[model samples]
Target: MKHKHAEPLYIKINSIDNVAIVVNNEGLPAGTVFSDGLTLIEHVPQGHKVALHDILQGQPIIRYGEVIGYAMIDIKQGSWINEAVTKMPTAPQLHELPIATNVPEPLEPLDGYTFEGYRNADGSVGTRNLLGITMSVNCVSGVVEHVAKLIERDLLPKYQNVDGVVALTHLYGCGVAIDAPAAIVPIRSIHNLAKNPNFGGEIMVISLGCEKFQPERLLKGTADTIPIKLESVDDIVTLQDEHGFKAMVDHIMRVAERHLIRLNGRQRETVPASELVVGMQCGGSDAFSGVTSNPSVGFASDLLVRCGATVMFSEVTEVRDGIHLLTPRAANQDVGQALIREMQWYDDYLAAGKVDRSANTTPGNKKGGLNNIVEKAMGSIAKSGRSAIVEVLSPGQRPTKRGLIFAATPASDFVCGAQQVVSGITVQVFTTGRGTPYGLAMVPVIKMSSRNIVAEQWFDLIDISAGDIAIGQATIDDIGWRLFKLILAVASGKKPWSDHWGLHNPLAIFNPAPVT
Candidate 1:
């Protein structure tokens, strides 16, 4: 059938690319003619690949000027190249990777850029002044949630400056081997979540008093090498310490009132953009993610790095196939090695589960024209921009250095967002090609749409539209600058769509350790 774009249209990422993604919304039928004299021999779905030339079986299928995969069958020019005819390529070997090589010349620092932020005692900056309630284990989630609602109704009205109360509840802390070597991931994650800059340094914990992750253990100093003293007893309110439900809620509310008062005392101050810790992630991604939204985010990331801000790009499986492309941009050999170490650890983790990176590709990805993980990864890494990888953070570890950081976490969107939050990101920018209502309670999440259709359909959910870049309505730089400005506005307490609607996903801690 003839599509809306009667004239065939496609997007070729690189000059050397042998395939291009069909840009028509409905896609063109077989025998469609193109301006470049290329004719489709078969129907090509929207966002699906169309081969530019004939390829022999087992030959590399090139996209983004790299081998996304190998053809499993001989493919003729102008034919659809789906996952069924392509085999994922072997991952790049870690040894002999280029270290501190080809680091791009530093962009001129953008000065005089500032945002209204809450400066923490520890020198970190917070985009939001919030009171975060920590749970010792999942058993206390209900209690914490009840207390949080009470704080909103009974306590928040008096604490005008406090944005809101967030109950940092997760599925760990009980029924798990908290002493396992892998347990550090979840424990550290929970620990750092309490210290996220947005929480304003007023920590409160609700415990069941019987879970493996005791309040003291979860708050045992700071997870980072920084020696912040712990005060778990004063900050914790255990259910077992109370006589009745009313008494329990009253005690928790009393502690929460103290935190809300402290948090309310905090006020937004003029701070340089350098104090911002921004996380970049994508979820429900589609083909346009790489072409439009991600590239714009990459540009903004580079801008943030230029301003001496810390920008973290994560999702191990999403970037696994592109590891070779990343190592060469490391700021030093140590950073390069750290990147390799995390990748190897994840490789082993996946192997232990009897799965591989291929499991990362969801049906939404395939429907969006991504055939395999290899193809998806190339798009995913674009969010990092071209900044040198200055440092690497293990799962749940907070970032100590500035500039671009690679915080390794599972490719699951919720899990990745949680890790980033715990890693101390004050704000998050999430791009989606297939729209999601994902947000976080602790920090503001800026949602960007990769396609015009989704942007138009979800105008209330999406904060910005990079889809204009795909449809020739705007340039990547245009969207990038717009996004950068929006980030400042959001950081300055302008509520984003997610926060306006109070839509937040539950915290999904990365618990690699065993249950019980």
Candidate 2:
């Protein structure tokens, strides 16, 4: 895909920016010259920055109109600026951040948009019709997974209306300090997972009987609970009380049949787009992530909000350096402080681990042209769009208010995905530059690529390509509208490539509590 002899191109994000990224497919050679007459002193790789002007040592390297790093030595004009010579800037002091100083005026409400979905007994709606089997602890995961397979093979075909069966299995329940204050993070996550809208209304619980987390605690969640709108008591299968492994399997299958019969009666109806709960996240990111995919996602996020849908953007460490920018956009002072509260809590947690936010960046990120965590954080916040932050949630907590929300969780892709599932995202919108095959069985994931090269190479795996914004082929709004329509299509029963191929990653529950 390299530009053989086409016009040299580069992208400078802001008028004040002194560095611009190479836009050619592979890169430009040493003698390559832009139409503006800037000649590359050395070979500059695609997505890597080229100094627009000579930068003296200690001068700030700016991008997205913020200081991403500082030059370690004199950088000649047209030279490639990368990790080896850039020093990361200090994070903005949390205590000194301004609160609610730049709240955006609300966008006009977008009305009349709808999607075909199954409405649950609880006011929630589901994009998929399926039976979910939840376990009280990791001890029952093996049995539950086995039972789920048997149900799919033997019982699923009989229930014509049901889409599929999912084993909501995770590694939590008995080993650690369950009563510790921090344990609530994982405990609440497991509790809320059973209530995910895609699971329909019936919850089948399988318990090891003697695990620290009992079925009762899972069903009767904490005070911040959304009442479980069930027609009757949730069925609980105790593995310890069964006579043998086969007996355990038989008992679960019997319980699952009852749910399948009930779930089979459900049907899809046209529901307003407002019922959609969408989560946005980035994984295996790159330099173009901000300029292309993330901005497009941000645009769609705003559209979802204007249409009265609930949208959430997460990953704490990825947004830490950019918190100063977000706090000012909070709906009010209280919301702004809530954003800081979660940031402060994570700061302390990181200190205890003897690491800081700098640990968040990856080697893949550097290869993709990101120099440090500061640069990554600046890019990560682009998915938030320009909407006012309506609310903020603690780790593993669901939202009380709608619009745009910030759900705090670690930057690990799997962990963040799991927490968002527990927080009640019916459909997840994942963006990537370096690319990932990440998908979730419970929810439909619409994979978006930040660069056309990735979208073309991983064509079958990617659902949408936002890379055109990097060149001049498309505007962010155009791709954003395109993604918005694709989301509605996926919500209305269209399968993403990942789902078509049955590609999915295992759930990684966040348990910050002690193992002992």
Candidate 3:
């Protein structure tokens, strides 16, 4: 005989939703029955649920004492709910979560946590040492790369500290709107590159003298900074006037030559692991992502947190689908409230344009069996592990606390990863189910997948394979340990596939207007 278990009671999620989500943790199949005072609703999966009473078409759907969504059609008690009966809802309020401080004692820390890094004059650490051929505008990108390529290959083998010459590329810089933050963008990007502990000593910036991004201003961001020798081809007025192509290339190499220092005198010191800031992200999600990769990342995140390091996760829209389970654990009321604000903002933002936020789900997600953002997010949140959310931070802001930090960012991975860098995440752990070959130009994207096909097909992009978990070959704890080692390796200068393949240009774009 098949065993049965009691269903968890679910209450109305929104004033507008007449229906409630019925959660059954015991793996109940569809069509199982449950009563909610008025009538019975059938059991859905553990993560999915629905109404037990008649719901008006526009009524809010409430669950976990919060509004998860809205009803899309008239519905009767006892009717089943899955992806079909409910609709995503909208809210008007927008703000950050309230700040709080009652955090729990952390779990165990990983043993001997360390990463090999380049020590900089400003006392910052870097994972890679690159010769930077910088440009102030789009027009000089080619010149920057040309200069980088002209350098002799064998000349740098003995310069053990240098990684390679890199050209920072972007599509904007010229034709940018005056009102846009165009002026600040290039400056910030260059400053990040120049100060990034991974860079070995200097930068040679070629400018398009007339663009919105001026060479001199770009110089100031990197101005009077430590370690990096700043070399500016300050004239943008006439390229022919500036030494021409070959001379410019020679100049870039000459700059590179001066900065290559002997690899001696560099030694690893015991920097408190708490100084480590790691970014957590998910992409190309599938059914098993939550079961495997996400939870594993969460475990690793928790381990790092225990060691006093800061672990950050974002894509607020994605995690919005399952905030109830998250809120009670919020270190304080402020964190919970900020989470609510972000959700409401997302709802209003999507509603005003008549576009469903479901539009954010990629085509591959559907093929992988994740039908909606709710299901996708439900799985995504598993990566935070079980730790007190020590703090909630604004975009580009670093975590002031030592435990787990939930940072805010628009839901784009590149944008968030870049923002993570601004937030002080020196390394990022990216999990994908269907698979994507994305890497942030500044922060390293250490890729992993829970599917064998993705791991095998994209071997060049993926660094680890959690697919073994799906086949019952490896436990989540084992994978977490494996990933812990990968993190240390990457942080210590072991190149991830993205770094090895040279896929490093990354940027963060924020929605200037409110999410709406």
Candidate 4:
């Protein structure tokens, strides 16, 4: 519903905030009047802030009830406030941060929520049944893609219950310092991607056999040492073992067919929402992201926790400035310390590259009214909701406990989504203000819009509209419940907008180690 107003509309997040963002679609021109009697001194773009009271140089600019930045120069009331006039604040110091000091009491448990999912042999549930062909190195990606298409064309039709084939291709496993301490990130990522519950415990590998990361090194030992056991020659197809191109293609097809036959027999069974492992992220963000989409996602995140589901929120740079806010909500001192450790590790990683968190914000972000990383971080952390953070994972490490988890990952959408897939997220929820068409072949991604304009412009791309909250058409709780129910429906095999359109982003591994 279009909200009609006699004058331009603006949104003030907190009573103490000295600035408010213009909510009118076309923005307000100079001398425009607000319902509160505040007149614009200059033209202010939609989603950009306008000063409510005079702000002297060096004084803090408050939003979301927190200091996002400080004034770089004296600002008069009704003046435009933007990135140029706002000096970014320093990140929270890690040492003196509170540990588990303000954990909220758990909400009443939400019982009996269920979805249709495929049960795996490893005691994990899968939201999709498919044959995922893992590549030992990037060299075999072309061959894997070729074989995947062949499987989809020939064998997939015969196996009616199986979804489709995906080549789990990545740019790692060779030509690099594989033994370095940081190499564990990519190594574990590949190992765990093959074991994601969505693949139904079926392990298929396509290898060149000459890569530094040999098939055995990627697979390791069977039994307790391995999460997914590979059985003999049938589980692997090696290009080196093939006499000709046709032989290589034939070998892969035979192996893929074997997995498909097994997968084809599987069927969805009623499962509780507790089996869900959801990953949340936001990209192409703007000022309204914090006010609308992220807070709604946070509320849904809390509901997931109450239902005994595992929820993870990541993007290290996006949450760095707000580390102090998270530490106090940790379930214990150890989790709090773990969070600190990840932050310190990322800080050093950035320093090694001689860049800072400022690199995280894009041109679109600034145009959408996010001044700096400090302001962006505050908005990004809103997805965690009010739940006590139960655990923290380093890059590529899978979660052991089932509640809200802080999975440390870079802010890049592809890398973070890939890392979360390795962490075993069967479904993902992505929020955006400026917008993106990001999706993963391994899981269903539900894209949400933070403003109604984008939602209306790109109607088919976005699956949900938290934009209603920003327009006063819906409350945060309304969208939160709607998202929660949609998650269950999507997990139950209802294709999301991305899936319906076949939009999938390639997997990009996070390799901090050097390439040879």
Candidate 5:
């Protein structure tokens, strides 16, 4: 397995898909003959299709060997099927899928792997180290950002070891119901920032003191840094508030001075692959994500898993429709039961909210030809690869089991990335079909554009353009190996393409279950 290489490839999603995904992008025309060593299907344009044989109106259209949709009206033995013109037949009645009962074999561990990471005081390892500044609410977000930016530009350049200064921000903190919250963005954001491997000490939390995020709770949750401190300013004096900001800024400078020794000494050390947790996420997906970037990431993730590393896969609603296909081999009965329970819990929880998990796709996904959550999820879930399900955890909970850890987070890309950070992902592999520039604070997002056009258009945001897959230039397996080594370089302290281009730094927390 490798992340970097060049070769043509195709993936058989299901035995029925007459068209396999084109890993190599060129030379094949709509009428060109295609073969998978089993069946000879005709070639169509990327994201389009070719017929396996003469078809009837009721016959299903297969790709990846599974039913993506059905032919509306068809008769040709060798004709191209355009996704735009395709329509699915009436839904086939579904029965309950049988649950697997037996414990599966322990998967083969990944081999010959090592990464440079920091050993935190908590015994957990981090991929990067930084002195972070946290905002208590959106009201003072600008102040926090100003203070952190000053440190990043002025102070960080002086410190050889510290990664840099990051100020984590969000859209909520006041004027909203803290309980029964519409979104627990602030808390989740802070929690995620604190958990990200990049931070090495207690962050300076700036607040006006009356916000929803009480200072005590925030401090209590974050007490690992050497010296924890807080500054609560009085809101009564408008003139005095300006003075307070200056005084607080001075205090942070002093606080920053205090942590300089520890921050400066932080260095990367050789760590086992087991200590690594990679976030698997996809956004701006198109027809190519499932076939190229998604599966390439999956194969890369499998390599990491075999080397004893953990990969966190999110976007439950998209993939919930295929739990049978997505569930990895579990370590034991306990692990397997946990995996099943997690899926069932999502079904019940969303139902309680009067929201069906199946309706989770965004407008962008629909515009790109995905009609429902099932199709989107089946494609997105491909990033996790085949591995054992070691544990299932809620957002912010650290993964104790190795291999694949299923983090229960919303399907939205940013929200899932935030939760993955809280679950201890040191770095992330983000696959996009259309294009997205989003990145999480503290965690380095490695963006891979699935199509050549999107990659060329958004080269600044996409770190790895998988356009080669669509152009018939590289096999997903070859790209998988390329990605694997690039990730190791990332773990070794190479800045992700996102960080190099200054693309992300937002935080979010999940507050599932009502706060009574």
Candidate 6:
């Protein structure tokens, strides 16, 4: 079913593009004529591309002025070009990627911007003063979860200044091959999750004493750098050590109160916006993602970089097709090569799993007019803006430098969000077109809608709308500045819609290691 627009409008990203997407609410019907006098011979869904010219079999279909795909058959000038008709193009060869060849001149510094934040003893800033109780083994997740609930209900009311408590539980700890070569990733990720800035330096781990991943191994070298165990591992709570569940709950409650007292004593102080570590990601994205929300995020990302804040953009498969565009924007050869290495590692990892980047796009993505990952990659990288990628990190690794960074992680929404939290994002800006209730318990997730319809329909869920850029209502710069202010406000203790409703999915740690 197709709907006709009174004024048939289509969005063409670039002059060189051979296709333009329909902009009508339900998409334009067949025989619809645009102001440019181009008649659509077939119905094209909103955000779905229309072939601007007759395409021959094997001819490239150009969108974003890049070869997103090739025609599977001879196509009409005005037909809807979809996944059924298009063949995805080959990804760029990693070996031949340009390194720092197109770095832009630095943006003018954005100074004097500040946020109210909780300052930690490790020189980190917390957007929330939370007591994050974690565990080395999933065997104790149930008890830790039980303890976190009790802490929230019984203890949190007494500590009014504390934001909340989180049970940082995951399925990675016990069963898998903990001694595998790649096991270090999820291991280090678990260790660093205890040190996230939002935790306010009161880190505690609940361990199942018999588990292979012991308490000592989890806390081995983190004491000096992070504000963790300077004394001994005696502070770690062990489930097996307790006599009963009641005893376990009571012991955890006692320890939680101590941490909550310390956390409650903490107050927000005015800190420069440069202390902000913002992670940008997109999920349930569509073609409008690149056209609107992602570009707006990219704009804000540049502003954050100018203000000396650390920003990260991830999802390796989402950026794989656009790696050529990103390599040249790297700060130097080392950063560029690091990006390639991560890409290559993921490529190998996927190969081992008998899949490829094509598996990254979801059914919702294709339904929302994303034909393939190649096109989605073009849209996904827009969140990084034009800032030079200063650093590249493996999944769950923390950042050592500021500015823009490429944190290589899987494109799964939950996995990316969890890894970003481990990488130290105080706030996250997530954009979507298919609309999701994807929130993070570890950090505040600001949801931005990629289309006006989603914004209107999910009004209570969406904090901001970049959909205006799709219409003539606003420019990317306009939304960018607005998003920047929103980031500052959210970081300064204002709750985004996700946090307001307390809607968050459990943290999904990226464990590429074996499950034996």
lDDT (Cα atoms) of all candidates against the true structure: 0.90, 0.91, 0.64, 0.91, 0.66, 0.90
Give lDDT: candidate 1, residue 38: 97
Error of 3 at 202 (Å): 3.3
**Residue pairs of candidate 4 with colliding backbone atoms:** none
Better of 2 and 5 by lDDT: 2
Q: Model 1: per-residue lDDT, tens digit, 51-121?
A: 99998999999999999999999999999999999999988887756777777777789898999999998
The local distance difference test score of model 3 is: 0.64
Q: Against the true structure, what is every candidate's RMSD?
A: 1.7, 1.3, 7.3, 1.7, 5.6, 1.8
How many angstroms is residue 283 displaced in model 4 relative to the true structure, after the best TM-score fit? 0.6
Model 1 score (lDDT):
0.90
Regions of candidate 1 where Cα sits further than 4 Å from its true position: 1-3, 221-232
Over the stretch 1-516, how does candidate 3's per-residue lDDT look in tens digits?
Answer: 232334444434235544443333233444554453444444444323445567678876554344545677876765655556667664222443333344556576655667666666655666666655556677877776665565537457656656666665554455665234423433444545444444544555666668765665555552223233344343222344556676666655655566554323345544555556688999878656776789889988888887777788888777766665566678778777766765665566677878755777776765454546766676788888899886877554445577888887667777777667656667899999778878875667799896666788887889998867755578889999899878877877678998888786545444333210
The per-candidate count of clashes, in order, stands at: 0, 0, 27, 0, 35, 0
Name the regions of candidate 4 deviating beyond 4 angstroms: 1-6, 221-227
How would you encode candidate 4's per-residue C-alpha lDDT over 5-120 as one tens digit per residue?
46688999999999999988778899999877999999998899999999999999998888999999999999999999999888989998999999988988999999999999
**Which predicted model would earn the best lDDT?**
4
For model 1, give the 10-residue run with minimal summed lDDT.
Answer: 221-230
Q: Please report the TM-score between candidate 1 and the true structure.
A: 0.97
Ordered list by lDDT, greatest first: 4, 2, 6, 1, 5, 3
Model 2 spans > 4 angstroms off: 1-5, 226-234
Please report how far candidate 5 places residue 241 from its true position, in Å: 8.9
